[model samples]
Target: MSTARDYGLDEDYEWPRPQEGGWIADDLDELPHLPRRTELIDGSLVFASPQTRFHARTVGLLERALVEQAPDTREVYRNFTVTLNERNRPEPDVVVARAGADTGPKLTRLLPGDVVLAAEVVSEDSVDRDRETKPRKYAAAGIRHFWRVEENDGLPVVYVYELDPATKAYGPVGVFHNRLKLTVPFPIDIDLTAVDRRR
Candidate 1:
């Protein structure tokens, strides 16, 4: 059987570039020179800034939990950039890929089909982006599972989503807390307790 290395992504390509470690603004016409995390919102290049300690811990905890709860069969990613086609580039906090995608560049955009799940850990600046805007965008892409980890209020709250074809808007799969493991429509179920333990 062919391994993930057989996918043929040239690892030699220069992937992530240097930026001052924060979000910088630019017009859409001036995008090619940007580092890996830039996104286009309403047609402008907007940088996705560094995560705060709250943001960092939440993401780290969730990453750990996913590793424990998800099957050893697939790959999970954290704080990575994923392109919504060519125009939009919202970097999700976590994405689950099929097992075969493991041998590629860490900074490359995930094609729509390769993704099994997409997650966002909300910091203050991420509120508008995560809960409001991304649902419309993610649902339109036909993604099977989406999650919003809301940490802005200083407590980790999990919002689960399953895209609904009839509404064309993502509807709540559940609103949950650490008391129960947050289950997903995808092939795996993840523990919400790991991230909520920050309290």
Candidate 2:
């Protein structure tokens, strides 16, 4: 039998099994004191170590840039969970949604339809998920835009993608290094180098 430590899970981590009511978003809400970052993927709990300084810097830089460039009608948030489905609630590094999209008394999760853009910053522990699994799921859920930020030789590189409605897949739009200029969801200009410098 596999143990939590064998899977690099913390001792306090509660593994969700299908037989035991399975894991859902509500379960995450119940555990407000979880030490590590956690997400639900296909009813399985995934735990990740805390972000590195560079990772946090990049996420913050992107959030600030997006907020500054986005129109007031759009909302920009960082480290927010978007409920893709019953068993999948991934907290993206940054997300942009239509203003007033979340109407609950208190903000909970953003449904796929409520999201216009979702962005992820690559981390040592999350390369595959950020590059492959997430894009497929996000596209299948009809998220229009997805951006991935990766580090190359200690500098930030942004890959922009847009979902093709007919195919339900993301097509590469642009790869930016120093500056990012796009006019899809809205006109925006971002200085990629600034993200590194801010560190």
Candidate 3:
């Protein structure tokens, strides 16, 4: 049978086993030799799959667009985790957080209230999480806006949602095909078709 020795883990290195109540968000920051982009969902560790070219390009494009359009009061972050509670801290592909949330270089997470919008680019390996789980959690955390990007024929189709405070649920705002224009979170316009274009 394969063992920790076979994987180069130290003989004394014990894996962080799941807790009966699930792992808390703080446990992620303390674990040694954890993989990059590891997340906590319902107190369990969730590791990210290898990112694909399409996912990378889409995320880059979105980040650039948001950075250019986001006002000085809002800052854009890529692959940063937002702490929703003690047991949930999921990283979105792109996050537009309030400028005050940028504590410093050493800061590791953002609170939900610091975020204005959270976006995810759907990948084959994360279809369910991106489409269903993450959005549901983001909405429950009171994030104002959410966007899900899907690859359709090598182009990105963005589905936008706005959270309804009364219901604490997301309502479809719009679906952008070639262009994405919005004025709610902030004035923004982006060319969704430029993912494959030379910068």
Please give each candidate's TM-score. Answer: 0.71, 0.87, 0.91
- Give the per-residue lDDT of model 3 (tens digit) for 16-85: 7876898888787788787668889888888777688989999999999999999999999999999898
lDDT of 1 by residue, 1-199 (tens): 3222233324443333434543232222243445445566544455565567777877787677677667765678885555665556566888886766632254455655677788888776668888888778878877778888885356567788887878767888777665335445334454544554654
Q: Which residue pairs of candidate 1 clash?
A: none
Better of 1 and 2 by TM-score: 2
Winner on TM-score between 1 and 3 is 3
Alpha-carbon deviation at 109 in model 2, angstroms: 1.2
Please write out the lDDT profile of model 2 over residues 1-199, one tens digit for every residue: 4456655667766754544656876566665544345777776677765688889888888888888889989999888778788788888889999898973334767888989999999998899999998888899999999999999876789999999999999999989988889997999888877876744
Q: Output the worst ten-in-a-row residue range by lDDT, candidate 2.
A: 28-37
lDDT of each: 0.64, 0.83, 0.89
Candidate number with greatest lDDT:
3
TM-score of 2: 0.87
Alpha-carbon shift of residue 164 in model 2 (angstroms):
0.5
Per-residue lDDT of 107 in model 1? 43
